[model samples]
Target chain A: MDRAVFFISDHTGITAEALGRSLLSQFPDFRFERTTLPFVDTEVKLRAACQRIQASQRDSGQAPLVFSSLANAGLRTLLMASGAVVFDVFEGHIERLETALGLQSAQAVGRAHGFHAQGRERIEALKFALDTDDGLRADAYGAADIILVGVSRSGKTPACLYLSLQYGVAAANYPLAEEELERVELPRTLRAWRDKLFGLTLAPERLHLLREERRPGSRYAALPQCRREIQAAAALFQTAGIPCLDTSNMSVEEIATTVLHRSALKRLRW
Target chain B: MDRAVFFISDHTGITAEALGRSLLSQFPDFRFERTTLPFVDTEVKLRAACQRIQASQRDSGQAPLVFSSLANAGLRTLLMASGAVVFDVFEGHIERLETALGLQSAQAVGRAHGFHAQGRERIEALKFALDTDDGLRADAYGAADIILVGVSRSGKTPACLYLSLQYGVAAANYPLAEEELERVELPRTLRAWRDKLFGLTLAPERLHLLREERRPGSRYAALPQCRREIQAAAALFQTAGIPCLDTSNMSVEEIATTVLHRSALKRLRW
Candidate 1:
């Protein structure tokens, strides 16, 4: 039987969902029907959420699991009365934080995703990522905090976007073209920015599958071509003393975090 | 004095950082010095993190606050002994989840950001977003889950990127060009997909500043021009019966979440 899970929050529900999903991933035995209720600050919305939880409980014949980060005390109290097993994400920690800091929490709503200077930085970084995507403007590499280089379809674009969006990092990517792959040395345009370059490489089989999805039955998607490109990229990374990550088993989040860790680049906080 | 805050995890520390940041936002009185230690699954790394935390405590004259989602029991125990005020993100919740579902957790590490089907979906969505960005490929609108229509620099590209990266939503964006803004009606190309269109508008002052950052001293950056284009876009949204959001005060996260909520689009779970 599939268990019902609800992520409730006063704002965008992103934090709640992220933490809740992490917890749920540990429990692989059960299938979950998940729902996210964001912007649930007001009493009216709280009541609506209560009704939804009640419905889920009635239908499933079990109290649904509710993970919430409601900052408002009243709405949180009301939610607890909804006959669901609620896990307040901030309950145990907020009081402890207050005690540790010797201060009171403002308990404000929707401060997590508010527009601020960090937001502007993220927008600018995103623009930089798009502008320099696929090595379109190598001249802009001077301003990039980090540049990702890899064979085509080797997970450069998504990693760059994740770094920009999540941490406000100015990340640009250059896709190694066929001509560049045929050579053993770093591309001339990338040599000057070698300090900022991070390489992404994947298994030849995985690369073949990825390229095949884009263009099946083509020489570009052939396994031999994928193997040759991967070999050349790895050799280039070794010769240039550039750090490279194998991205076959890693998601963009993992890849981006690994890059930051290996490169010792601090994630800029907004 | 700023308190040190550590986000520790066995995988990417994104979940820990997100939830910790949200909790800390409530206590706006004190400044926090934050560090993230991800992929800390080994005993060596755990010892290193403890050293960092102990160093922070010694430097700050107070124990640091550690927020962790370490899945391994031994490492988690080691983390608890680090002498910091540890808030294990899954400590209290995982047991409850096991009892609730009558199953034990897999207790795996790095499950949150593993390369999976959803990761592939997200990469595909990102490619679609880039391919169709700024009305480059209007014909590709047929494949988009949602099409964002807005004036230039009104938060279209970032929102589309967020929707794709976070939710695997194939979002495409079209900038309302100067000629299209002059008529006050939906563009002829957009007329076909009006149902999937979501409009984004911002305050004229904000729009003017944004445009000025891109192209200084241009007529497009003038306040009057900004106001005129905004008015025309607003009138066109009304004429086309499309829902619109004022993005002056919202982040891309907020904008993407609201679009999902308003459009009744379910965030795809892998």
Candidate 2:
């Protein structure tokens, strides 16, 4: 079944989107497309998302499933007629909490539970890696919950580490070597668990700018090298059917969330 | 001088507020208060905050030192007349980054650095502890840059561990014992490092709920005992002159940020 998710949140879109990703991480192999509309109180934003979902169905020529985690109840009627399966986290969690607590869920108190599922393990793992100074924490193929493969200075290491620090994901990043790029093949270890492998590539100019920070005058930071490696990496990723994201202008939050949301193995724990 | 810190940010206020607490940790003798205004956009919210600062000054009969890290340029004019010393992180790091890069300040890109700088030793200690599974990370008292102490569920342990992981700060935490609470005095090891020791306390009810999750039908989770221990802990903290936070309502992000913001010894570095 085709599936698409939409988040209509009261605050910023980040909360709903983050919640969606964590939940998807629990349910792997669900072909899902998801998007979020912030400040959904307005009809215009709501209608645009609805139209976009409709367009996706039209383009694919397949009936799609829709799940909404909305802060607003007003959209319930509006979305019911959209001909997509709808599962709402807001209601699901609220019902569960109320059942357990044997009382009505207060908005403030309930919101607290949303943040309770701690990334404690993830945070601890990061500490273990950083504390030991054992460079293995940096190796992507072995320890990472998600391995980020990309050309040098494509924001692989920091982004993966940030994911580890912030979310408790054991994010190990492997840089694409020139030899690997020449072969246009994924890393040997990466090929074993192709499902967990994700690629991050950026614009050649951006790569040069980021690299110039570490080594100012070197062929390693040259634009030609960046362009070549990125092109080769993209080709390998496409060949392996591993999803790749172009993180050229995206913020760290955007890049991490996009990868989490679009990944085939995302299971929703939040 | 009496000091109180306020964090204003375009991002989540929880993060700014956490960072503020971290900065405060640096000056152990400073009597400081802290608060945050997250997702602040309206004129009324700003005005209310200014009034609160004024009221605080009037009550204390002293000019309050205020640390504000505002992301928005709009608040500058409004706060110019306030009777508090405001340090803005948004503007503070620009020159540092430029000097490091040996580039003209104007030519330096603003959003470049995001990594931990201090406490590498502690991270290593924690890593060594976790790998050996010896729980010796607990015994890393002398090596710790800072030590955390509180009751079982007061968030001391995780916070210290987070510091160890993120910045490699040697962090040791000791849970207060029943006898220690009865004595209503700082534990021996904590008293020895009075200047470096920080305390964490949470609302009794919240502590009870948290304890109940880990263990149900235990004396620790009982409301009466929870209240008693928390009160005793607070009294001990007051006598020791160690600043403590009531972490019941706050998220982990909030707690960690406040610790970092207050810790004078650390700063954001790559």
Candidate 3:
């Protein structure tokens, strides 16, 4: 039987989902039926959520788990009395935070994902990322916070976009073509910004599989071609003293974070 | 004086940052010096983080707040003894979850952002988003989970990319060109996928300002042009009975979540 879990929030519910999912990942043996209820800031919505939670509890004969990041104390109180196992995500920590800072919490709803000046910066970063994607505008590399260098399908585009959208980092990616890989030195266009460069490599088998999905039975997706490109790319990274990550078994989030860490680049927005 | 806050995790530190930022947003009056320490899985790295926290406490004469999601119990215990205000993100909730499920946690490290089968799905979704971005491939609409329709610079691309990267939802976006907006009807290609259409609109002034940044003094960036396009787009959405959201004051996360909520689409990955 799968347990029912709800992630409730007054805003976009992204934080609640993230926190709940991270905790639940610890218990991988159990299956969970998960739902996210965002923008639940009003009394009317609270009542509706309570009914759904209670019904789930009755249907399963088990108390449904509720993970909430409701900044409103009154709504959180109402939720706690709804016959569910409610975990107040902000409850235990806010008091400690207040004590530590010698101030009271504002308890405002929708503050986490609301519009702000930084939002515009994030948009600009996203534009920069798209405009510079796939080595389109290498001249714009002067303005980039970090530039990702990798062979095609080495997980560069997704990592660049994730870094930009999530942290407002101006990230651009350049794909090393076969001609560039055949040479022993870094591409001339990237030499000026070597300090801002980070490399991504993947296992040859994985690279071949990824390329095969896009271009089946083509020379580009051949195992030998992938192996040669990867070997050459690795040698280039070693020669250039560029820090690299093997993204064979990593997600976009992991690759982005590793790039930020290795390059010592600060996220423009949090 | 600004207080120091650390988001520590054995993995990417993204969950800790999200949870910490949400809690910190409650105290907007206070300025925070934030740092993220990711992949702190070893005792040596844990010791280094403790030193940074302790240094901040000593310098500011205030206990630095540490938001940690370290899955290893021993590392967490050591973090607690570091003489800072440590908020163990998973402690109070994990015990309750254990009690409810009658199972002990796996206590694994890097489980949240590690590679899994769903990671591949997310990558494929990202590729779909880019391939169909800005009406590049209308033929691909049949395969998308959702298609976002909006005028240029009305916040479609970022929303589509975020939806694809974060939730593994194959979101394709179509920019409503001047000809299509003037016609005051759905684009001919989009008629086949009306059920998957979601609309995004922005304030005319905001739209004009965004366009002006790209092409100064152009007719496309004029306020009258923006107003005309917006009014036509709104009427088209209304006549087509498609749900619309004004994205003038919303972030990309908010836009993506609202689209998922209004469309009743399930996130392919958590």
DockQ of every candidate: 0.65, 0.02, 0.66
Candidate 1 reaches a DockQ of 0.65
Residue A51 displacement in candidate 1 (angstroms):
1.1
Q: Kindly list the per-residue Cα lDDT of model 3 for residues A1-270, writing each as its tens digit.
A: 589999889988888888888888878877789988899999999999999999999899999999998998899999999989888888678888888888998888886732455787888898999999999899899899999999999999999999888889999999999999999699999999999899999999999998999899999999999999999999999999989999998888888998888788986545
Per-residue lDDT over B1-270 for candidate 3, one digit per residue giving the tens place of the 0 to 100 score: 588888899998887888898988888777788888899999999999999898888888888889999988899999999988888888678888888889997888876732455788888899999999999888888899999999989989999999998899999999898999888888899999999999999999999999999899999999999999999999999999999999988888889998998899996645
Worst 10 residues of 1 chain B by lDDT: B109-118
lDDT (tens digit, per residue) of candidate 1 on B126-215: 889989998989999999999999999999999999999999999999999989988888889998999899999999999999999889
Model 1 residue B224 lDDT score: 97
Q: List the residue pairs that clash in candidate 1.
A: none
Clashing pairs in 3: none
Q: Model 2 TM-score?
A: 0.39
CA error at residue A167 for candidate 1, angstroms:
1.0
Quantify all predictions' global Cα lDDT against the true fold: 0.88, 0.56, 0.89
- lDDT digits (tens) for residues A167-193 of candidate 1: 888999999988887888899999898
lDDT of 2 by residue, A138-244 (tens): 44345556777787767664455445555556666667788988997776756776767788888888888777766887888887877887789889989888789
Stretches > 4 Å off in candidate 3: A113-115, B113-115
- Name the top TM-score candidate: 3
The per-residue C-alpha lDDT of model 3 at residue A201 equals 99
